[model samples]
Target: MNSLFPILAIVRKDISVWLRQPTSIAATVLPAIAFMVILYFGAQAVGRNPVALVVQDSGPHAQELINILSDSGAFKVTMITIAPQKAEDALRQVKVAAVITIPSNFDAAYNAKKPDPVTIHINNLNLDFTNDLRRSLPAAITKFYADQSAINGNNSPIQIRVKETDLRSQDIDLLRFELVPNLVLLLTTAGIVNAGLATAREWEDSTIKELLLAPISKATIITGKLLSGWITTLLIAAVVLVVGAASGYLRPAGTIYWISTLVIVLLIALASAGLGVAIGAASHRFQRVTAIGIPLSIDLFFLSGGITVAAFLPTWLQTIAHFVPTFYGTHALQMAIFYSSNEGLILDLSVLGATAILAGVLGVLSLRKSMLA
Candidate 1:
């Protein structure tokens, strides 16, 4: 009880100091929320993009393809009966996201069983817009064939039947689910940098030297600092979760899902706090902490697949990322919230738990050594 008093006192003191500064809370939480808003608007823009549909064939087959595009609802189709050059001009002027040109021989080639080509001219300035066109156009073509086959009672030579099964039992918004996990990693990175900066501030203000003279053990002091950081990170994570929930991005599987998520978040916070403390102990200046913390946080985020899809990374980088704590943290949250099964959950949790313990030990030892010197 006697030894615990110092740790408790330090925690209270740190919390009080943090609560007095509203700017700090704003700095930590607002940007995360703002990013969520940006994602929501970006999704909306992607959903309803307009495309130019240039129809050179007036035959029933050609008109059927154009009708298929209009009915798909993935795009707003503008039928351009004018010259293909005018359609290309529309694309260049950004009046449409893409231009789809149906050849004059489209119906003739279908009847004669010859090759027919449909041209699509699109601005590749935005990769997302171009990709959307690529996907939607093919799906429209498939639908046209299916519709024709259904109408003509098997007279059409080509027939395609699609059997769709979800990887999970329930439906998930692919874009929202993918981006929300990245937001969790962003929150963790912010926690690490914030904690490191706060710890370095004590040295900058000469208060850490005074702390060295206190009767409490250095271990207790270090634990107290980590505890304060852990608490702050947990609060920030709560805000992020709330934002995710409000955005309709996160779906709760059950109470256990949330409970497990919270546990993983706490472990991540502990690891981040430990890393921050180690950086603070090594660098006595706040500038050094900022310099080290920001880049280090970015690297961790990149390794954790927050910047890009993990499967797309190089083989060596993918191997290296396996050792990164945030990788496990992000994976754990993704499995808990997005996936229906507990596949890989135990492995992810074990890695995070081990990382927290290892980092905490090193951070405490480093801080004790720095302060005692």
Candidate 2:
């Protein structure tokens, strides 16, 4: 027990020294803010947006759907009385998201209680808008008839507005939602630069020999090195949290949401740091560790749905996501942000804890072998 004391001292000292470097905080924060808040919105306007709307059939059912879409605040819907050929130019130039073309038989089919053959000419690039239109249009058709029956003698149809409360704020911005997990994954890998390089750097600087000569067990030496990595990562993550708050990624609306995000990030960082040290110890060659560490971390990102949503994914994909640390990391972040989701926080922490334990044990073993050899 006394032997463990010296190693803990060294770990504390290393963290203290690293924090004294003024630029340490900057390295962790700027990327997360820039990628999440800046770059994404900068180029968003260049993507295809809405302007033109075409209606071949002037029926209450079709127009009611358009009104619902117009109210969404997502698009600026303009009435286009022009030919489809004229609308094609704007769609091609990406000025319009889609042409809401109504079939001449639209009202006839509705009155006859048959399926309408309305065609919506959409540019494949605007999948988000296209999907929204797809769902809204069908719903509007159902609502139109429901309302018409509600009225006494008028042929006019009424539209139904389903008030979907975005309990998680995910609906507000899909782009922003996608950006957070990548930031988490990137931060996790960034930890490797700080954590993986710690022991290797001490050896190159000729400090490890002095550390080993001190009154400490080999386990203490490993403990100190791992703690140094973990603490530095925590500091970096702290800066990241502040930056996320300042940049509006972490909002007051989801207090519990943000808390979960923080817990998940810390847990993943702990697991990630252990994995980083394992790379350093097993390879023994510092350059090789740096070379291999990033790619392996990236694999976790891909497996975790870092670039996409895990919800629509196949069940097999969901199964695969569990083994990756970022799977729990990103999923938990999303739940906190959008749904105020807190159901599985404990389970996520457990998975992350298991990862940290396994990776940490492996890391300690590798460090001991490398140091003693």
Candidate 3:
């Protein structure tokens, strides 16, 4: 109880200091908010594309084709008209990605079993948009043929069927999928900035000498500092988790899954807090610690699969990401929150637990050495 008093006092003092500093709080929270805003806008850009559809044939077959294209959930058919020149103008002005025309001979070709090509003029500006247009057209056409086969019995030319089986109960949208990493980023920033600033403040305010002279052991000081940061991070994380759950982004399977999520979050906060202590002790200046901590956390966020899946990255980049602690953190979080499965979770927890221990030890040693120096 006597030794614990110093640790508790240190934690209390550091947390009080953190609460008094508004800049430190903003520095921790704003980056995660900014990233969420960026991802929201990015999701809009990559969603369904706009295209022009020119229908020259006033036949039932053409009308059916038009309905299929509109309902395919791929293209936003911005303009539907019989005017080829109008489509040309829209294409030239970059108003649409492509001009798809169902020619006058479409009905004639179908009745006579003749080959009639539906003309498409693509903007071909970039591969992403270009490929989207290319793939969507074929899929729409396949659906059209499938419908025709159903109506006309064995007379239809092509028959292709696709049956899908989903591994999970729900589909995670792009924005929601990204929310996990942003939450991780928030916890990491809070942990590092809170603890780092607390440690650096001692040097900046000329209070390190007092701490060195105090009756508390160096280990107690380090533990107190880390606990303060970890506690602060967990508070921030709680708010984030509540918001995430209320917004429908995070849905744990049951009590066990919720427990798993909390464990992962706790380990992440501890590891981040330890790293923060090391930075603060080594830099010994408020500005220097802030500078180092923010950029380093951001880099770790990206390397740990920020907005994109690490598996889809270049081979060397994926290899580097595996070395990052947050890679395991991110993977574990996604599994628990989204998949509701424990697959590969053991490895993730093991890595995070080990990292927390190693970082804590490094932080303690670094602060102790600084105290002696």
Please give the CA lDDT of all the candidate structures: 0.78, 0.69, 0.85
Model 1 per-residue lDDT tens digits across residues 278-326: 8887787778877987887778778887756665789999999898878
Clash list (residue pairs), candidate 2: 168-338, 168-339
Task: Show how many residue pairs clash in every candidate, following the order shown.
Answer: 0, 2, 0
- Candidate 1 regions with alpha-carbon error over 4 angstroms: 47-49, 73-86, 112-114, 125-132
RMSD of candidate 1 to the true fold? 2.5
User: Global CA lDDT of candidate 3, please?
Assistant: 0.85
Candidate 3 Cα errors over 4 Å, as ranges: 30-46, 88-95, 123-125
TM-score of every prediction relative to native: 0.90, 0.74, 0.90
Tell me the deviation in Å of residue 370 in model 3. 1.0
- Candidates' RMSD to native: 2.5, 4.9, 2.5
TM-score of 3: 0.90
Model 3 scores worst on lDDT over the 10 consecutive residues at 28-37
Q: After superposition, how far is residue 40 of candidate 3 from its true place, in Å?
A: 6.2
lDDT tens digits, residue span 315-373, model 2: 99988877676777777676676567676878778887787888788888878877787
In model 1, the clashing pairs are none
